[model samples]
Target chain A: MARVVVDVMLKPEILDPQGQAVQRALPRLGFEGVSDVRQGKRFELEVDGPVDDAALARIHELAESFLANTVIENFTVKVEEEKAEAGE
Target chain B: MARVVVDVMLKPEILDPQGQAVQRALPRLGFEGVSDVRQGKRFELEVDGPVDDAALARIHELAESFLANTVIENFTVKVEEEKAEAGE
Candidate 1:
């Protein structure tokens, strides 16, 4: 099976309150010298079999229609290979 | 400035209702041929300056303590170079 990753984030022009909250809380948590924290969603999809171009296109379509709110968010889809364990 | 990405996801043993909901809805939406849809969070951090090892360590600490719920979720962090725009 091929693994597909979809990263969905709000448009740059859109405001992200959750991100702002994290930024604000960082100083209180003693994590200083950081800024601009933007939070988003990531979806890891395990395809039933090998991922082909057709499958990728369908995944993109799904991302556009279901995985992201196009009005405010944008998404990118990519195929990923599982990392081998250490010493494997 | 540099960009860092932190991907946080529930452990394999943890139940992901949001992911399951999407998987169930996909067939209804006519997008099939997919399984094991796991949903997670992605944090895009914009550092004020260059990212060094000290900065990276701090980011990792922040991710472990604030960004991820160690009780059930696991997270990974990586540095990302901004993709140049087309024709740039």
Candidate 2:
């Protein structure tokens, strides 16, 4: 099987209250120097076979339509190398 | 400034309802061949200075203590190379 990774993140212009809450708590926890934090989503997909160009295109469409809300977020899709397959 | 990325994922044995929902919706949307799907969180942190060893270590601590629930989730932290800096 082939693995694909998709990272969905909020646009820089969008306000992330969830991330802000974490940023606010950092100082109280004795961690400092982090200027900002943005929280997003990550997805790992295991495809039935080798990932080809068609698979990539389909995955991008999936990312755009289902994974990310383009109005406030952006997403990136990339195929992850299958180390197990490579080692075999 | 430097960017640090932390990815938090559930343990393999744990059930991921969100991912299962997506996987079920895929065929309905005319996308197929994906056997498994796992959903997780991604955090993008902007630190005030260059990312050195101390910075990486701090980021790791932040990830463990705040970003992920250790009982059910696992996380990985990595420093992203500053492309904007290299372009300068």
Candidate 3:
């Protein structure tokens, strides 16, 4: 099976209150040296089969239909096109 | 300033309990058609200045020293080498 990675991030113009809250909590948790933190999200999904245009299209559809909100966020997709070196 | 994006993900050998918990919470939170969710992380950092070997090295160091725990995770870095068309 091929693998796909999707990253979903809030647009720059949008304020990320959740990220800010987490950043605020960090200092009290003993994490210092961080000026700011903007939390975004990532997902690695395995396609049931080979990588092809159809599979890419389907994955894009799934992302839009269920995985993300495009209105406030932007997403990018990457497919594993070749065997990974780490598997060696 | 050049932009850098970092993706931090749990190693495949590691079980993701937090991701499982979030996935379980999704359906009750009104998200349907979602079978699984494995939460990971994304970071987009704007370098205070230009994109150079020194700056790239510094970012990598920060990621290692502060942003992530390397033992259970792996990360990839991408630099914005060209102007984005979206900014047009």
Candidate 4:
């Protein structure tokens, strides 16, 4: 099985209150030097076979249509590289 | 400035109702061939300077402590590649 990853993020101009809350909490948590933080969504889809161009195109369309709000968000789709099933 | 991306995902064994809802909606939306869908969160952190080993280690700690619930979620942290500021 091939795993496809879709990362959906807000447009650069958009404000992310969720991310802002985390960033604000960071300083209190003793983490420093973080200028900005933006929170987004990630989706993982398991496909039946190899990921070809057509599959990628279809996934991209899916991302744009259902996974992200075009008016305020942008998304990227990529196939995950295979790794050993056991042990990191 | 450097951009660090942290992707937080629920443990595979965890039930993902949100992702399941999307998966069920896909076929109704005219999409097919997706066996499974899992949803997660992505965070983009803009740092003031270069991302070095120490920074990465610190970010990893932050991801563990504040960005993710270790009991149920896993997170990966990476630096974003620089892209042209202009059009894609």
- After the best TM-score superposition of candidate 3, give how far the Cα of residue A87 lies from its true spot, in angstroms: 16
Winner of 3 and 4 under DockQ = 4
Question: Candidate 1 regions off by >4 Å?
Answer: A84-88, B84-88
**Model 3 root mean square deviation, Cα atoms:** 5.8
lDDT of each: 0.86, 0.84, 0.65, 0.85
What shift in Å separates residue A2 of candidate 3 from its native position after superposition? 1.3
Model 4 docking category: medium
Tens-place lDDT per residue, model 2, B1-88, is 8888888988888999999999999999999899999999988888888889988888887788888888888888877875221000
**lDDT digits (tens) for residues A1-88 of candidate 2:** 9889888888889999989998889999999888899999999999988899988888988888989888888888878885221000
lDDT of 1 by residue, B39-78 (tens): 9999999887879899998998899889998888888888
Candidate 3 DockQ category? acceptable
Give the lDDT of residue A5 in candidate 2: 89
* Predicted model with the maximum TM-score: 1
The residue-level lDDT of candidate 1 at A47 comes to 90
Q: Candidate 4: list runs displaced more than 4 Å.
A: A83-88, B83-88
lDDT of each residue in B1-88, candidate 3, tens digit only: 5667766777777788876775666556654444555668877665555767876766676666556678987777678656342200
Q: DockQ values for all predictions?
A: 0.53, 0.47, 0.23, 0.56
Model 4 chain B weakest 10-residue run by lDDT: B79-88
Question: Residue A10 of model 4: what lDDT?
Answer: 82
Q: After superposition, how far is residue A33 of candidate 3 from its true place, in Å?
A: 13
Q: Who is ahead in DockQ, 1 or 2?
A: 1
